[model samples]
Target: MRSIAFLSADFLANPWPEYARFRAERPVWWADEIRMFCVFRHKDIRTCLTSTDYTVEYPFRVSRQVFGETLLDLDGPRHQRLRRPLAGLLLGQRDNIGFRAAAEDRARTAVAALRPDTELDMVRGPARTVPLTATATFLGIPPERHDWLLHTVEYLVSHLDGSSGDFARASALRAELEEYLLRLISTGAPARSMLGEVHSWVRDGRITAAEAVGLATLTLAAGFETSTGLISNALHCLARHPGHAAGAASDTGRLRSFLKETLRWEPPQHDTVRFARRDTTLAGVPVPAGSALKLVLASGNRDAEVFDHAEEFRPDRSTHGSLTFGHGSHSCLGTHIALDVAEAFIGALLARFPGLRAVDDPMPPITGSTFRRPQALRMWLGPKGES
Candidate 1:
């Protein structure tokens, strides 16, 4: 870790230069400090993400240890069963209108918190809470646990770049979260909540108590954190390119393009960690069995072969098959959810404060390497003349 630039302040701030270097030189480089292989090129990253030769378990048991063997730690039929609930929700759940309306309404409510004629930080306001409450409601978690749940899961995922003490803290937080999920399962949640469906699965033996708990925790954490990142990134993008603001907030077609570009440009979910299931090779570099690897989706998203002017944010340039969320079996299930949440929140914000614009030109180059987002989305929320 000492020699690796990955944990350095500079790298966390701007890793693209180094990522580009890796893609050109050592496409499949190994980090001896952590004994993990990093796949940099978009092509190789695609294989690692889509191929069946990697597992999130084994060398990456931290996920299992913390989240208690959720779908992320499973494979094949087992993983499929646990994924059914989220996939169902993503597929509309036969109640698409109701679910989408609830999420949009929650988004509007979150944005409505900001005052009309003042400066504000979107990160602290709607960017965080919109997804937090929306995920909680969808999961059927009580409002009492929403705030606590957000911080707890934030710690859990943020520990990837922390010390052993940080890991210990994450473990402790995981215990508390696990306890909450289990208790809620034992008692009840709303019948329409995703948690309720998972709870029913536990009741009917479709999944075990432990699996159910893991499923719920993963749902809550992934749903909220991923959505928050996309929302913040979208807001940051909106601030940078004010010309697209009207379209992103008002027009669905333009809004989708803006988000697709945002996801490709500065995707919230950066990388996916995995372990080699068997001896293999990525970009001609040997990967022995049990080798820990990081499929850097952030780098893959910028591969010039796939995206023209990969470094720039061009809304007109389609980002159709980009590796924004992830690839393959364990890919994120919240794509539509994140986009919808961002659209709703951004739309509501502009509706409330019509002249909202960035106080700083670029909104502080999105901080954090693991879960990237603008530290503070400072904006003048008043009309142009008032501001």
Candidate 2:
């Protein structure tokens, strides 16, 4: 009982050792307090993700009062219907070429803005810079409004940190997001952007106004942090491994490997929970219906049975594939966009600044928060052409 309480409170504080123990002792252990079964094994993680027996609860019911119903929480045809407009908006065939170019172009612009011989927080500068403009391009928000949009999202998302389960903060954010979406919709800008299309879809009776607001808010919430964390994690890796960074800088061919390894080393989305819709067996354990299951993706990625030297950050490791973007029907919709931004930013930074290293005070430490990310990354921007 005491151990379980400790796991609940400090799971984020020192998860690696706990994960290792769970992997060896009880790969599919149940936590009575949270009433959720956790998967720490490589195979169990893969199986839980790949199997259709489980269901995800985005704005999870307890959370729905705050987030409302979006595709993140839906299943079956309802989810399919809700995703159609977003599919065309976020992942359509026609949208892919343009969005990719637009994202990369925005990344190039951010890189150009970096000041030589000046140390800075990549999170505020390039990290926020890349996603802010890219999301604006996708949603048709003007670039000048980037700061406000980011600020709003930042405040709201900050609520989601280790303490977001609070009712007051969640309600406030949800109310503000609702009003913002309503105002944006009332402007009647049905052009080439997602907001416009969502408005048009709502007008056509494809989705309700509430649904549109929920989905839009979901997109806004998920857009920045994912990209930001990935870049931070990559920089954390590159700064520590100059050799790997240097090699990848010379040949962009190693970009994919670096990205894969960084994901394994420090995955952005650490865990995803699913509500057990019905009693089912997972990894040889019986899970009762309505029970919650938390899949520790970071732990799964580092499972010793799955990868050799699972704890070490090895760019050359071949089993670098991961469910960090999730798996099955609930897989992240922005995967390609995320990769493009991460690869472009990391690849460009390494190529441009060869002497980048973590600044001592705000150094990138593995945070204890469930979302495994560096809270801040301060890199020393050395004079060019010197080690």
Worst 10 contiguous positions by lDDT, candidate 1: 158-167
Model 1 lDDT per residue over 329-355, tens place? 877887888887777777677767778
Q: Write down the TM-score of every candidate.
A: 0.92, 0.88
Model 2 residue 305 distance off true place after TM-score fit, in angstroms: 3.7
How far out, in Å, is residue 58 in model 1? 1.8
Evaluated against the true structure, the overall lDDT of model 1 is 0.78
The reply for model 1, stretches above 4 Å from the true place, is 1-4, 163-169, 384-387
lDDT of each: 0.78, 0.73
Ten-residue segment with the worst summed lDDT in candidate 2?
1-10
lDDT by residue for model 2 (85-153), tens = 676667855553266666778887776677677898886678876876787677667676677778777
